[model samples]
Target: MQIVDRLMTPSPDDADARRCPHDGTTLVSRISPLRSAVRRCPACLRSWSDVTTSATADPPARFHSFRLDVRPEPAAPSAAPPAPELSVVLPALNEAAALPLLISDIETALAGESYELVLVDDGSDDATWAVIRAVLAERPQWQAVRLSRRFGHQAALLAGLAAARGRAIISMDADGQHPTEQLPEMVRRWREGARVVQAVRASDARGGMLKALTSRGFYRAFSRLCEAPMRSGAADFRLLDRTVVETVLQASRTTPFLRGLIPWLGYETHHLTYEPRSRIAGRTKYSLRRMARLATDGMVSFSVAPLRLATLVGAAVGALALADLIYIVAVALWDGRAVPGWASTVGLVALLGAVQLFSIGLLGEYVGRTYLALLNRPPYVVAERIGDSSGPPPAGERRA
Candidate 1:
């Protein structure tokens, strides 16, 4: 669909030639200033812009009072332009049932602008690919990337974001839990010049007591531990402008904590509150084990607090050991009796061993991440391409 039909209003400079962010192509103006202006990108899709500023320049006073319209000239017609609206990237794993509704909600939210939907299916052994194909068939603006295997949700999201062509990109869950209705507010904030719009979960009651509590606790601790500015209840359902997306893409790390990565990139940001909804269909992709692993990953990926704590612990243990040694020597020299309990020695030995092991494990986690980085493995490999067949299909597109 053409983008102008979706605009609630138009901008005053709507008739002026605008450059596409994805490609340096100039766009042709389709409508007048009163209505929405359709600027078809030379490389991608048509986009609509609101008419806030006037296309006609103010008349010069004094001698010019006699009046001339002094209206700006319209842009020349050009090749198909790149899409100008936001790119919505939804990472899916066995989420066939929820995909349709999620897409519908996003379409409704982005009613007035042109957008591209990139659905990255992360190795689902179900009808997820079928659903994606169906959506793309119905909507030419959509794209699908299927991975060869389950590269995990974060990797899938990264793939989709990498392929996004919008000036702004948004990432959210495919389970319909992330409310698409909040998108307009995000876009409004973007229009107000915020580069990043983070969605902070107002409440996660649908996630159940255990999961919700764990999530809250993790975020609370993480905020205190990480140097990066991460909100306590913020999540992956976020909108990023072109600058933020480009910066993030340049961060070439195989193991990525995207929620933390954006803040580290340092951009003007805004926050929106949305109650996270329960999954409409399919089981929860993030199991407890997966959550724990992700938490650990976030901790190590974003903070050095663990390492510092380890050093402090070691120092404290050494001081205690020295004090104990001094106490033993004083007892032998003055009291003439060694205050020794076999049980106490055994407990102390076990405690020290456990502490040593725990410290080693924490250090090893960081080392393991470093090792993975050194290996330089591709985050995900695409197995097939379904609709366009231009390159290898996404990984999950492969037939079993």
Candidate 2:
């Protein structure tokens, strides 16, 4: 096995002669308008982009992998290139440090497969967008989209999905928590007729025992509350078939929690579990408040069980009050103990008042959601787009 490299710019023969490092198929070559070398493997569909200086005596590539050594026998090229087989969509926020290594991990994971990396910057205040541009210069298969402001995690994922043109789409985070090593199995499962391939976390050590229990509780509650039972530990790191993507786009959910919606969409779903990696970069963007809001969104948008629970509580309280009234009247007639006890009366009033406030607050949650949905506000707005929009819809058209 040997390492090899190709020139940034090549002669017609040199261009046609390039092959995929993962597999020994002579690559189909084309030059992009940006003067970048775009090469594709006809057999495995793995793609490459070269945009270094265009000198004839260009230096050989320093980057090489043991798994991606040059092939002994170069396979013949096909007549036409096929569409990308996979789209790795990552939603990023203030992830400047993690972007470089994560992208490399993605390439390594899908070395022989025809895939594109779609990175959606969810209004990062850091140099994340700048890093994306730099990386794009190095790899033509990379596509970056910048959102106007922080649209939260789910919206960013939606934006990337909307911009991805690949037949199979995989959504993950940029925080390195979602392992790229599992990508191969996901693609394999997708090809094997699984419309939705969900990645489940074996365990999370980031937040210790209490946080873990809380997360587990949320999933259990969500499963019971909603019609669709989301698999425990199911996460955003999952693959979606093209049809599944279309199905998701059809529903205008203002606060869509895809872990639930994907299952509810009624496709053949498969699950894979892997231990989540610890973050190597900045602190998590999800604060306590954000997590609570996200939890609320998942519950309220997907289930009516909360509203039902409130109603049941109201009825039960009413029944208890009626029984208490009957008991008091009987005591007054039989034992002449009808005098009101100040302490008990005060306690009863306080308890009843608390319940009333709780019920009102619960009702307000549903009402607010309904009112927002009726207003038809867009879940996200795109401030600036990073990549070319030749295939996927533009951000402007992706409103709501």
Candidate 3:
């Protein structure tokens, strides 16, 4: 832990005899263009810059170099703690005011169970990461991960799931709308051998009539198009067995749509319906734009029905045009004349053009997804990881 603080500007007479201040060992010097000369201790690997000998000059001039602040050696990594039976993952963003109560509720609900709480800060501009750090200081069993930036709610949840070291994992929101009281029941269902324990939102009193209608319509369309038994009002608040977690991580290497993907797995599942509570503090993070993005991810990732729909529409349009041509020919043949209208021709052309453009745009969406996948970008980047638990292994080791 010693630091070499003294200056070492060696002259031509004793250029090779400089010794390390910390260990009294000989220093190795490497000449460089910008740095003039770089000195490093072979034994300890500590580095220093020597600006006295410029490579471009025949007779190097002497100059003082700034000292770098000394840094302590990293502590040795300790053995990982025992794996918990259950891991609760919560992804938070700008919910600093709601965390303390949420943590307390989780603790009380899982009082007797061996569980660990993993809080993920999804690039919150607020003090969300600061609060997470305080929690980690007091609770050794807890874990916190801060992403490089906000990768959306699903990516944050996936990051937590990647770092969870439990036989079963439960994921929920940190905005306090998801009730922790239902946790025990979800655990009970897991104990009864259910691989997936879904917490379906029976009712959202906070959501107005328009939102309810849109939600219902989306689910119905999703179920019909994707052909998966995705329950209407099913939410991200759910418990997953270890196998399901691993499978999801492997399958969803790109963007993940958990609400749709989970049901598509067709695993043995147990559904529990509960009414959603209002946010404990602050406003809803999911704006209309984000909601639309999520809906697009769900539909695009799990189903190709949009492309099929385009084909079906094209076929229907072509059939109608063919019938109209037959009728026109029949009228002209029987009556020897036909009425012409500019407004009718213009309307038909415009309608057909709109349908063609819509079909092309739909095809482009699918192509864009493929292009992104081929690029193989990671879903999220972890800027910092803090915990006593060693979570999961690296992707390479896991594959091995």
TM-scores vs. true structure, each candidate: 0.72, 0.73, 0.75
Candidate 2 residue lDDT tens string, 181-209:
99999999998999999999888566788
Measured by TM-score, how close is model 2 to the native structure?
0.73
Candidate with more favorable, higher TM-score: 1 or 3: 3
Instruction: Report RMSD for candidate 2.
Output: 19.0
| Candidate 2 overall lDDT versus native | 0.78
Q: Decide which is better by TM-score, 1 or 2.
A: 2
| Least accurate 10 contiguous residues by lDDT in model 3 | 391-400
Question: On a 0 to 100 scale, what is the lDDT of residue 207 in model 1?
Answer: 74
- Better structure of 2 and 3 per TM-score: 3
Better lDDT candidate (2, 3): 3
RMSD over all Cα atoms, model 1: 17.7
Q: What global local distance difference test value does model 3 have?
A: 0.82
Where does the lowest 10-residue lDDT sum fall in candidate 1? 60-69
- Number of backbone collisions per candidate: 32, 2, 0
Q: Give the Cα error of residue 84 in candidate 3, in Å.
A: 0.9
Local accuracy of candidate 3 as per-residue lDDT tens digits, 302-351: 88998899989988887776677667667777985677554346556765
Question: Which parts of model 2 are misplaced by more than 4 Å?
Answer: 1-82, 319-341, 391-400
For candidate 3, the per-residue lDDT at 211 reads 78
